[model samples]
Target: MRDDSTRNTIIFVVCSLALLLLYQVFILEPAAQRRQAEAARKPAAASNTTAGPVAGTLPGVAAPAQVRVVTRQEAAAASPRVTIDTPALQGSISLKGARFDDLFLKQYRETVDPNSPPVELLRPEGARHAWFAEFGWTGANVPGLPNANTLWTVTQGSTLTPTAPLSLQYVSPAGLTFTRQIAIDARFMFTVTDTVANTGAAPVSLAPYASVQRQGAPAHVGHSQIVHEGAIGWLGDELRLIKYSKWAKDGGMELPSRGGWTGITDMYWLAALIPSQSENVRGAFRVTKAGETNIFEANYVGALRQIPVGKQVTETTRFFAGAKTVPVLKGYEKQFDVPNLNWAVDWGRLRLLTQPIFSFLEFIYRHVGNFGLAILGLTVVVRLLFFPLANKQYESMTKMKKLQPQMEELRARFKEDPAKQQQEIMALYQREKVNPIAGCLPLLLQIPVFFALYKVLSVTIEMRHAPFMGWIKDLSARDPTTIWNLFGLIPWNPASTPLIGQILDTTLHLGVLPLAYGFTMWLTTAMSPPVGDPMQQRIFKLMPLLFMFIMAPFAVGLLIYWTWSNVLTILQQYVIMRRLKVDNPVDQFIARFTGKSRAA
Candidate 1:
């Protein structure tokens, strides 16, 4: 019975792994390659596709036919601008449309290298992949109300700063004066207030509108399903999200809510608009096409307001364009009553687990000042939390190991009498108070915890570029040192070699973390009861090596967590085995190393 169960478990593990490997190699990898090939096939001229219909666009506003493409420098040179120089941001506001068109995140860089250029968020309008925020008054049948080409004159400060804000004024030909005051905080929030005074003898109907538009799709979109890249928002009742591919395929979406936020989001960055929390607004996400390029837009239109003659109406809206940091998002969410803004971070379906894990990890990180140490701290916490369950599990396994010889004898004696063999095994189990399945409880409970950790390590911007100790510069990335080049001692790159090289770099890298995890896995398995079937035992012995290869490409942070967990499990099992007076490989190995007597 023991032999059959072990054989069945071995077969199951082997089949599952084989199926997963085959599916990944044939389906997922080929699909990724085809996507790369399709992206490569796009014309270089597509980057220059300045096909327009960009400006003066709202739910009902008309769009222009075409706009010329130009370099970011040339586009910036073409427009008069108000300089924005904040501690965390450096950008310029284009006066032509009063658009937030040029922005660079001063606190972040394009790469881990300190010398790399700062992260460019909003490029100029005529530039390739131009993304910017536009705000204006949409009037009904009122012509000279500051359209796209209406350039504004700066009436206030020259350089916009946290201490000093700037205001721009535009007077239409029809006796209307428009004033826009733009202010920014030390972080990423920007406040824009628009006041229009009807100087003529007649009243006008006008509504405020804000739009975040991108001329073309990002160079790479939907690279991974793990990260959400597209339109996301917190509508009145719930959060709404649409990926880029689905956003284009589904035509578009419209939602009417009292107070909410809407924007386009990438993995680590976000450009969102927060409308007046007390006003009703119509929010929309739209996609248009220019030649082969797809243009994306997310905007909201406020309710129409009646402006009396000689009187002015003011509307204020806030914008958030920066990294998806949890504390920052939560701060804004609380200060402005924005619900679930941190939901912008893809917490996945495991929010119940992932959120708490990330919070705990962040807390530990704050105390330790290193993400690697935080991960180790988390592992220890998790182990302690599950110590009682794990103790019972290891105790059951120890009892099973003590009864293994008797079970084998019963199985061999009743080889021809299967029913009798089962009966004897059950009687023996009753006599010895052994449970064969209690050992699986801890493993069964670990799946959710493991997946939650994976989500935290993968999606959070805080984990990006976080370094661990020696040779681990980025916790969010896979281990860089590969065994193929003897961990850089050979001074050869596997990537330079071609087919097998690519495989070695990705699939079979066998880095130190993965190897350490594999060793711990083997040690834990060795301390457990041996499988009765020889073939099953041999395959089980190789399972750790197989898993090492399987886990080689995951984030180094996850590998560290798992390896440390395994070490803790080993210690727990050793202690339990010592209390039970059961023989374990740890004591045997220690005995051999130190020439001491082994545990009986």
Candidate 2:
């Protein structure tokens, strides 16, 4: 007879290695390629791509736009601009097409360093990796309608501020008078009121439309799976998400929605258009090509209106382009009557639990003033809530441990009769009033909460660049300190060594938090009832170590939460084991330590 334990252990190790290889091949490799690609590209570089306005194929939507890639300086020099200055924003609006093409976030930085450059949100078209929002009228066979090249002169204010708005005016050769009034709040919302009059001899037909366009996708941010970076919208009581990969694979999406918003979102930033609440509009997430680059656009075309001679049409559209802060999104959702604006955070299918978890975490952070401490507080509250289930789980584990010897004896007596051995063991369990599967109830129940907490920490902007004590500078990121470099004590960069440096960094990132989590996990696993099958027991014993490596690259905030939860579980289980007179790892360790001390 072969030893199944040895075979299983070998199989487990191979499977673990296979998983790591797959992770490297997929997640790690793609992230490296994106980072490398970003580093290689220069914003000032020019391209030979020809571009113009996008004309929608739909009946009412026309005068489509084109794509151009040019230097940032050329973009600025292309047309005169109205400056935008606010508490949280600094950028310019191009007088050409009256587009918001250049913007930066004032309060946020590209890195944790205070002196790092501010985050760039919207950049001009023809600039490398361009992202901007454009609003105008699209008309069928209406030559006088404004296009991207039509230059507008400022009619109201030169500088757009929270207190002062900017109004631009453009007159077509056919005697059409168009005016756009743009206002920005202190934070991220942009309100635009567009009015056009038909001074032409005859009536002209046109439709109002707004679009947020990105010339290309940016580098991946956060864990790509958990953090949404693509098209998202809440239309007709449903939140729709189309990820970038999926968007690229599946060409375009068009939905006829009323009073809804659609936008392209990064992990922490968003550029969205909220159409007027009064009218029905067709919202779309579409992609176009520009010299090998994919241009993504989220746009809406409202109902077409006919303007009689000397008559005018006015419409209001709101655009949000800035940080995806929860409070800010929620405020806009209520104030502007936008439906499910907060859903931009990618709360996932477990939103029922994730949303409240994030809210409570925010509340705790507000009171304690530290997010790391706030997570610890959350773990304690969760443990208290699940105390009863945990107690029952521990009680069941203790009973199972006590029945181990009798179970083995039954197996030996009925070795030749496998069915009889199982029947006898079940009878023994019934007599002892032990529910065999009860030991896993508490852990199974906590899985959803664990996932919810991970999602909150991973996706929320408030947690980005958040710090804990010691070496943890960013809770949203993985721990920076690595065991390979002796936690930076040694003057060496493991990631600069050679071709193998990155592989080493990814595979062996044993930081203090990860190590602590592994130790606590092992302790809790040790307290659990030993498995009856030798093969199962050996595989179970290896699980903690294998999972430690798997989780080592995750956000330290998540590791802190799990480690604290494990510690609390251990304490509770130890107490239950002692009260029930069951032998446990804690008491055994203490006794052995005391005995060795006496002997010494």
Output the number of the TM-score-best candidate: 1
User: Global lDDT of each model?
Assistant: 0.84, 0.81
Q: Which tens-of-lDDT digit does each residue in 1-600 have in candidate 1?
A: 653674475458556855675566446755766776787787576654766786226643556436777778998888888899999999899998888989999988887778999999998777778899988888778877775677899999999999999989999888889999999999999999999999987998999999998876676664455678888998766788888889878856888988889998888899999998899999888888777767889988999999999899999999998999999999999999987899999998999999999999899989989999999999898888888888888988888888888998998999999899989998998898877766656776886798789889989988988999989988988888888888889988987888999778855778889999999999998988887778778877988887788778778999999999999989988888888888888888888999998756
| lDDT tens per residue, model 2, 65-151 | 554666777877787888999999998999877788899999999988889999999888777777888888887878767766778
TM-score for each candidate, following the candidate numbering: 0.94, 0.90
Candidate 1 regions exceeding 4 Å error are 2-30, 59-65, 591-600
| Model 2 lDDT, residue 576, Cα | 80
Query: On a 0 to 1 TM-score scale, where does candidate 2 land against the true structure?
Result: 0.90
lDDT of 1 at 364: 91
Highest lDDT scorer: 1
Error of 2 at 221 (Å): 7.0
| Model 2: worst 10 consecutive residues (lDDT sum) | 1-10
Off by over 4 Å in 2: 1-68, 221-223, 592-600
